[model samples]
Target: MSLSLIFELSIWITSVCGVLVALWLTWRAGKQRDLSALAGFAVMMALWCFGHLALFHGYQSLGMVLLLANPLMPTFFLHFALLFVNEGRACRPWLTAMTRHIPWIYITSIGVTLYSIWVNAGATIRLMDDRPFFVFTESGALNLGYTVLIGVLAHAVLLLGWRHHSGNKRRSILAMFGVGAWGLLLATSFVFPSFGIDVFPYPMLLLPSYLLLLVYGVVRYQILAVNRFANRALLALVMMLLVLCVIAVLGVFSGRVGLEALTNVPIWQLWLYSLVVLLMAALVYPTVRRITERLVFPGAVLNEQVLDTWSRQLNLADSWTQLVSDGEALLRRQLGQTVTIKLPNDTAPSGLHLCIEQGDIGWSAHVEKTDDLSPGMRLNLEVFGSLFASSCAALERSLALAEAERKRLDEQHLVELGSLSASMAHELRNPLNIISMAAYNAPEETRKHIKDQLARADRLVGDMLVYSGKLSLQYQRVPIKSLVSSVLTTLSTEQVSIDIQVEDTLQIDADSHRLQQVFINLIDNGLAYVRNLERGAMCVEAYLDSGRFVCRIHNNGPQLDDVLTQDELFRPFVSKRRGGNGLGLAIVKRIVDAHGGTIVHRSDCGWPVTFEVTLPPDNTEGDV
Candidate 1:
């Protein structure tokens, strides 16, 4: 009924709120830094409010005992500020040493205050309008100085850290300082009452509000990685505390003023009884919620309707690209974040990620970690990502099956074509040999022209048979340098300078005749390109690499056209050179394949054109 009682009741309710915040911080301290210190600060603040409550209720000894909590309150506050600003990074050496020694200074101040209280020299209490004022002597006044000094220092640290940092860290520190400023002003007002001042700690009424802002900071800015489930339980606790406070106020009004049947019972004891009930409710909230959740929504991470809607949206997507886009949009819309869906091979940007895996398929949904996102939201994201990955797996299987069928058809067609071409080449070679015999008997000038044309036709027919017929190897120990030199002797290399880099001792088990054809085709291909240069040059290099014999023939000429693919270059009748049959490289490829070797076109190491041949090691081997 009285204004003083109204103020007292408000302070009691908010003090309980502060204690709840301390419990929440303590719960979160394991995963976050500076939270333990903040929890200590909250506890001290709650004690400060209760101490005032005790003094007003005329419990002098208990109130003075509670006042001992004052010295460490700002100490914990400054410690939390320093840690919050540094943000888990190592602080400056001077600041570290200062933080380490600050608590001892506060402890000594407590010692001096204790001695002052023991002497009981100038400790006096006066009553005005049901509010008790404690008059402090010089020793008691020391607490006020400690409060001012440490409180300013904490804010100063916060300001400096906010100014010095950039990007997200700067923004986080700024948010902390902004929320903390309100609590700082209200907390400082409590000091006035300790100095025999008329201040009633009305700021205590907003203690619950100040604590709620910190919770908002934790959820919105990720100042702490608090558990979302715990957040829900804590909300339930706060609500119950409020309900209990309301019930206590009604009881006081009903009994003392309205009903008058229980007028003998004191109002302060009723509030105390309410406080005890609230504490018990806070302790049992988690157990109660667990029991209730099982009865309501069994085995569910979040609201089932929301999860089902997200699942439907994902399943209805027409394509993978659309699915990924829609899923990212959903996350951004619900969580208020910058979201990206990363394919398996994509590099994920730095952030919080919900990784999804279904069998061998895997990808991630990424978001900037600006908040402790709820479990319900995370479960929804996981469901979306899992569906996307599943779709990718199914699509990949379909493509693979189609590709396999296509390759089978291609191989079958090539085999039929090769048989027909081989038969044609054999029949044509017979007529070419007869023409060579007739040309030898003609007149000298006519014979020379006729023989040249006949020889060209014979070479083309021989290439066709070699490329389209079955190739058989006659494996023997062949020296690479000798084989390359023999191939060169059969070619006109007078206009080109050839460099051989094969080791003298290098030998491999391969058909010498077939290997000779491989070099002749490759080196001739290089020479045809380079011989036109003013100072033509070419290099033939061979070595053993990883149990395979490797050879590279490079020429100083213009590189191959970009439009030409390796497959196209090796196919029959796909020549880039003038007046060529084009079966030279095709025959070369067939021979290499027979010998368990591979040939590829390259332009590397400052060479304009190169053909690299790699062969599997056989019975005979020598290191280069």
Candidate 2:
């Protein structure tokens, strides 16, 4: 082959090689790849194809063909930089905007170049149509400005975004810049009056090398599953296109060439033919992607590679659901073929059993047993019996321990009750003796004077009996309105007002005698606290609320001392009041709570010093 013919062939092959590689990369990127990145690459490849074909079409000097693609060249370079650095979040808006505007940046840069060509300029706009001697000198102020502006801007953007990228990102972006730099150098050789060199477009070849590095990085990271996607598409599409292309080439070249005959054709027609087919494929990509996804993973959101992925994650149970209890797991790992369990003669099945157990406590287990033994069959009788014996023994020991503990607790409770009753009986003796002695010796006139003391003595004894469960509540239908009035009348407070506003017939299932004591304790505290206050104001009100008998006692007194934390106030013998035995409120709380009533204290302004009690409709009869 002659050198020129060889050179032409290589150049044609080089251009063809660029198309093949670009197509493969895009296909590898697949639908899951960012459409913006794919589209950007597609634009670059399409424009580049135009530039190469224009050169081959004997229209190389116009510069318009390559100019059309100049903007995309920088854009494609920036994309590679991003591909290296992107860690899988959607593309940043600002970076995407900058990238999208790059084609305009290139077109704007070429605006001056095109204007120079239009104006029939002197030094920069030279027209020549030949080889080594026909090289033109471009040195007008406009041309220099144009070249410098584009080169500087491209370099500046590279430095800003790509230079500081760390790790493999830095390496990949640097390679992109290296290829871009060479491309610029080639363009510079063509325009500037620097020298005569046929290597003006030589730097363009380095684009593929940089792209190769990028492809390797992609494969290394398994990025986009590009290698697999690209390889499959290349194998399929190339075979289809080549078979059709060659057939068309042969038919065009010779009308009667046999199917077996190898026919050669021009590179130009092959490119256009391949391009027609490629464009048609590109047009159908959306449909192809949808169809392929449905066939592979119907619900897949990101077009994941099915073969590359595992169907079921065996031990992912940890991530899926918590194993809060010890038990069997539906694991993907292999397991024993059959599970055998030994059971005691007396145990019945319960849910959530052991997979296999053998003991005297009786083995409770889950298993796959499919044997029917006739009366004559001896079914490994000794081995099975031994296993059952151990399980049964373990279960029996555990049950015995639990039963012993329960019995001991019951005995201890009975002892505590006896001790309490004895102590209470002894404590009541002295108070009872004092009241009895006073009652026997006092005359009728002095009896009134001793009444208060006698009543207190009786109250103390009643408390002891209540604690011992010997105090019987005389359950009666006590009208709540009448009850409140009785408490208010009996415990008359000169300094506080007792306001009764209950339903006409709010009856309660209560021993009115004991409830009268609960009222006395509450009213006494209200009187003491209110009397000491400068305001000296207190009010007790009763009403129906939320289908219950609600009663509230209010005083404009200072808050209970912080020493009466709510929990402490509920305990017997614990009180915050200056003069209190603390048993009063404790007994009141116990009685009310035991009757399924509710009480709460709200500490706020305007409604300060309040006691709230609510009782459900009772087990007594009343009109309403």
Computed on alpha carbons, the lDDT of every model, listed in order, comes to 0.72, 0.52
- Model 2's C-alpha root-mean-square deviation from the true structure amounts to 22.7
Deviating ranges (above 4 Å) for candidate 1 = 31-33, 87-90, 119-128, 188-201, 214-220, 223-624
**Relative to the unseen true structure, what is the C-alpha lDDT of residue 257 in candidate 1, on a scale of 0 to 100?**
65
For model 2, residues 369-389, the per-residue Cα lDDT tens digits are 324322111122222233333
Estimate the overall C-alpha local distance difference test score of candidate 2.
0.52
TM-score of 1: 0.43
Query: How many backbone clashes are present in model 1?
Result: 0
Error of 2 at 589 (Å): 29
* lDDT of predicted model 1: 0.72
In the range 1-624, model 1's lDDT, one tens digit per residue, is: 775777678768767977998897888679665778888777877887787688888887767766654667777778877776764453567677777786686677567557655755224355447567455566655555665677778878878777777766676667667788887777665556555576666775566667666545534455334446557767877866686677667766776566765455565665567778777987998789877865554434345675677767766666657766777777676666655776655676677654443443343333345366565555556665655666566555666887899999877776776787778777887887788787777899998888888877877777766776656677788999999988899998988999999999999888888889889888888788888889999999999998799999889888889998999999989998987899999888888887778999987667888889999976432211
List the candidates' TM-scores in order: 0.43, 0.33
lDDT (Cα, 0-100) at 480 in candidate 1: 93
Q: Pick by TM-score: which candidate is best?
A: 1
